[model samples]
Target: MNQRALFAAAAATVLSSALLNMAPAAAQDMGKDMGKEKCYGIAKAGQNDCANLSGSHSCAGQAKTDMSKDEWKYVAKGTCKQMSGLTADEAKMSMTKKM
Candidate 1:
């Protein structure tokens, strides 16, 4: 193959590899958006994004109570309170109440 053709092939291979390597990171970042915030008392039972503040479980989808006060879910930035979800302070209050 011509030198130009060889160089083009090599560049294409490199670019494809780079894009494959970036796919997972991009997906993870999308899941954990920089502009989003974790809103407590919003996730239904078995719907939390991850572990709970109370340490009742260490994984997602393990919440024992619907809308548990200590659990959190990622919500868009500045939309947590507007969604009727609890702020950190309100969540704390709920934590003190009987489940």
Candidate 2:
């Protein structure tokens, strides 16, 4: 195969592995005082405030402000898949670069 194609394949393989191994936290916490999807601490970026929990690296590439509520949901879903090493601050800025 060509060099470009080989590099692409390798990158895809690495991405697939990271995604396959990652686990996303739920929208609820064990404590009843916290609101639904709020206690988990993984807010939908600009949708709400969060203390910044651990998550995946791929989330660093997601967009911060979406056009609508539904779009935001998809954005958050993708962001949640990132590894535990990912930080909300890093993700917030990276996704906000476009707007």
Candidate 3:
């Protein structure tokens, strides 16, 4: 390959390698954040966390119903049970009322 092409290939390879190495480290950093709390029944439809408890799906933004009792999302710790937010029990109650 020409010198310019060789240089571009080398740069791309290095960038790709750096990104691969960073992925796991970024995931670890995310796990270390203990301030997050899982708040159940507060997520709007299509806005829950990574997955539903019932194994219906394994991705966020896939919830079929809003404020579902079994749905949960992580928020700042203690924020979910505040006066404005609903605790897990409270969420279940709200869902029961709507049913």
Model 1, position 82, has a per-residue lDDT of 90
What tens-digit string does per-residue lDDT give for candidate 1 at 1-99? 999999999999999888766653453355465777778988898887776777776566678888777988878889998977887677878777855
Provide the overall lDDT of each model, using Cα atoms, as 2-decimal numbers: 0.77, 0.38, 0.70
TM-score of 2: 0.25
* Tens-digit lDDT track of model 2 for 1-99: 999999999999999877644522221222224321222223345543312332222232242543212121222333444522233454555456645
Candidate 2 least-lDDT 10 residues? 66-75
Residue 83 displacement (Å), model 3: 5.9
Candidate 3 global lDDT: 0.70
> Ranking under TM-score, best-scoring first?
1, 3, 2
Q: Whose lDDT is greatest here? A: 1
Q: Is 1 or 2 the stronger prediction by lDDT? A: 1
Name the best candidate (by TM-score): 1
Candidate 1 Cα misplacement greater than 4 A, ranges: 1-33, 97-99
User: 67 in model 2: Cα distance from truth in Å?
Assistant: 41
- Model 2 residue runs over 4 Å out of place are 24-99
**TM-scores of the models, in the order given:** 0.59, 0.25, 0.53
